[model samples]
Target chain A: MPAGFSAADFLYILPELVLIGGAMLLLSLSVLVPRRDGLLLWTALATVAVTLVLVVRFFGLDVTAARGLLAIDSFAAFFKVIVLLSAALTLLMSAPYLRVEGIRVGEYYFLILCATVGMMFMASGVELITLFIGLETMAVSFYVLVGFLKPNPRSNEAAVKYFLLGGFSLGILLYGMSLIYGVTGTTSLAGIAAALRGQDTSLVLVLAVILVGAGMGFKIAAVPFHMWAPDVYEGAPTPVTAFLSVGSKAASFAMLLRIFVVGLPALAQEWSLLFYVLAVISMTVGNIAALTQSNLKRMLAYSSIAHVGYLLIGVVVRTERGVAAMLLYLGVYLFMQLGAFAIVTAQRRSDIIGDELKDLSGLSKRNPLAAFAMGFFMLSLGGIPPTAGFMGKMWLFGAAIDAGFIWLAVIAVANSALSIYYYIRVVVFMWINQEEPVGSPIVIGPAMKVALGVALLGTVVLGIYPQFLFEQAEVAARTLQGITAATVVGGQ
Target chain B: MVETIVFYTLSALILGLGVAVITTPNTVHSVLFLVMNFLCVAVIYVVLEAEFLAVIQVLVYAGGIVVLYLFVVMLVNLKRDPEAHQDPRRLSLVGLALAGAVLLELAGIVVYSYSREPSAPVAAAAASPVQGNVEQIGWLLYTDYLIPFEVASVLLLVAMVGAIVLAKREL
Candidate 1:
């Protein structure tokens, strides 16, 4: 016990601490409680609710604690809310499917909670080591989640592919960190920025930054490093797939923003060009690849890669407005993507697994409510106006133009237009095409219906009134301004 | 001079072990070689004066993860000759060329880096006592890096649960 290290430090981290504690509690309770039909479902909902409340209360305060490695700032708090809500929604969507598939397990919710904790820490991470640990935590948990249905050969294959690719990326990232550490002799982001000021840029440092960018690009499923996305997304359980696409991807972007904006601002001239090239490549490749994918999940996976390209446009600008737009885009993306996946979860049958594009044909006739929700989600994703997805892209590309990257913004808009073909293809098949009734109308439970409704409402409302999220994004962007501006000024 | 010789020798051994781990035909043999490679890495960590990390490298990577891999390989009951003989085809030729290209690139970078005018050693021996020792690292970990340290533990917890869930059918 050292001086000034009180229980107060632990209290500041109470939200994350509580989630970890809750996971252990749930693990024990799973044994005590009867393994009824809905036991795991109810426990998961309760855990997410308690964790969400803790996040809200923690964010309500205007305090920074844990020696700055963890910040209770609005930026981390916002992402924490997003991750929790996404996990809760995914769990809600998983209930009926898990029951149908006979794959219910207490460890499922525990892993989700733990992964959410990792995401929260990722957003708040102010140091390189913290970021790496958070990333590995998230990755390891996801590897298991992807392979949870171990008896299924496809699930096992997905897990192995994800783990190998993820492990390789981690090695690259760690190597980059070691290089940075060699140059700065420190792991703290603030210290690294300070050390970089006016220092003659070394080739080692430049290479290190590139490697770091490559690692992050892979995590976000950007082009050239996105080879694993479609297979992993297709093979994983639908709910886990939804969580990976939304919660984990958003967390990676959050960490990327923090690192590039706060830690490596002095090298903006060097890194921004790299981001620009990557953004173009990601958008072009992702859109072209997706045009041919007939598998719904695989297309979404490629579309996700393209979406990462759009988000990279924000990072390339290296401006406060760009950060805000990126955050806003991620928030909107959470709902739209999760909502689409939720509908897929509902459509699952005993014989058929994922909802292929053809499977969705004539869905409008069979389940009009689900079809309408899915339609809204697709429209939003395609960047159609008056949808949250469109508004999100608007903010992102607007920030790019504002930062004088008009060409990059133009490319993104073009990519957005190209995306519409495939996105609308799903809608057309759902509404216009016809297929035989495979089974009875899928009975969605109360929790899933509510989750879908909320996601739908969020998509429409955010699209209609983007100001609320934009304002929060603005504030979160400003929180890092002190570091960014100081670094730029010092570099000059 | 003696220290430099030892460093080079250890580096060569580590590299050799790494190559063996990758190219070995037997998966079990490859895993065993991986453990050896990990142990060599731990020795390198010790030489670098990262004592805590060295211990962790041995305990976690060499001891735990390798054992897990061995268990999986055993349970899978792979056939004695799981893979066919390597073909001397165009693809293999291309792979060899790519490997050569990578080696040349690395060599170029190393040569370029070392060509720069060498700076003074900055009293490496004296600095070692204060900076590279365990006490300094522990202080840093407890102070500025504390939150990440704790979060890493939580991450491990999640990983443990995840592994259990993946490997077992029931809770």
Candidate 2:
């Protein structure tokens, strides 16, 4: 019976089990201990940190766990680290913000942990149905978290729009899954690739690929499927928005890489073209639209879209270096994007509207540290020299060129130049534009400081010494290729 | 021949009810049509020898989901027709173009499959045709797909919490 349901199988999913256990425990504690505001936050952070340690301990030890539904290799370890770091940082940011926003419910932390667990599932899932369920779990949790500020109509609207569009996209993705399953009669990544070897491509399979691509495009906020991102990001709680933009986006990319690269290698030529078109349009559309945004959150939302464009080039290349570059870029993104949003969260108060561009006016005069950090984040996001974002762009564009997609590199470079204008505009408002600031020097709580400190350290360290993280990413990418190799051997 | 006749009759009923569900002006009647469509689809499943699926379809879709639909339709209390707000412009041409494209694609697939050489079936190894349908499904669900089944329960739990958190009048 192939050692079904053994103790070792349970150990493979220990991190997820810990998270779900922690989430449920917190759900109960929220009811039992209603007044302890910091209790849930601390517990959630500890849970994620513990999970991170377990994943790191198992890194590079290639093993498929939970009866081959989940992989515990370097690839999963790498993304587990990303998802955990983002979750921990978001929880840190959420503590102070929640207090200020009067969201006293401990279920807030519960939902965040649940979502993180879902993302962890997405990172490790080797089966299509498992990934789909993980995606839905994450999506459902986000639907609630986006509308966490129940009194705010914009939050409600964002939640409704996200849920409706998200459900529709899920349907499209399910249809694609069913079609693929119908054609190959398997939902396992290794099996799918094995079945596809030497099999002639058909029109229905192409259509399935497109449908699946479209669904992922929506999650990562690629253009033409990115209509919901800005509104959702703008209206969501800043910490949740940071989580969605970095954490959820990273998880989606991980799922995409698993499905398209490992499972559908035979269709690489077709899907890479789809990604190329998506990349070009996403970059162009995101940068151009961001130019006129007055809300800082909305501006960053568009900027995220543009960043997804640059990330797509890595997928288009379909090389190990390309995937490594993408993973590195995501790591860089987690720091800078979350750092920027953490600064925004620090400024939130009942008396002040913090997300407007004018809220940043004369920020340097008020809180120099905050302004300096925000300025650095904007610089990195714009891919300026000597920042992690710049290094990330270099790696991605270099990979594209190495793969002979010179046009993609050229377009990305042009888009980077175009992106600088808007990213720098935020800097200009913070430093040079001398309008009276709307709020007092925002109090940076201890938790916020910790979150900001970690983000800053990651961003600056990676920017200066990119070689270490790059090597780790390379290992992770190679682990992914190992799956394909195994599949090929199985086919033989 | 009798199986073919039953399949065609159920398919027509399902298709006709699906159209009625979308086109009907009255909200309650539309929901009723949807329930009929679900029941017809359940019957079609039965004809295909998927007895377990047919039972679940009738129970979950026709019985459970239809009740929920009726509750929502009545609770919303539509005073004015919902379709009245739609644009009055004659956009039928665009709809027709899209529908025609879909029709052409389906036709092309049918033609291609008919003309191509028959390939070996892929799933035959996974489940032997001699086994009972429900037993085969139950074995696979508990064995190969156990993790996803558990995760699906988590998803349902999250959805339940979401509905309560978002829809409840008071926090």
Clashes of each: 0, 0
Candidate 2 chain A has its poorest 10 consecutive residues by lDDT at A483-492
Tell me the lDDT of candidate 1.
Answer: 0.81
lDDT, residue A423, candidate 2: 89
TM-score, cand. 1 vs. native: 0.87
* Runs off by more than 4 Å, candidate 2: A486-492, B1-9, B80-131
Where does model 1 exceed 4 Å of error? A1-4, A37-39, A57-64, A486-492, B23-43, B50-144, B169-171
CAPRI level of candidate 1:
acceptable
The C-alpha RMSD in Å for every predicted model, in order, reads: 7.9, 7.8
Model 2 has an lDDT value of 0.87
DockQ, per model, reads 0.45, 0.42
Interface RMSD of each: 2.0, 1.7
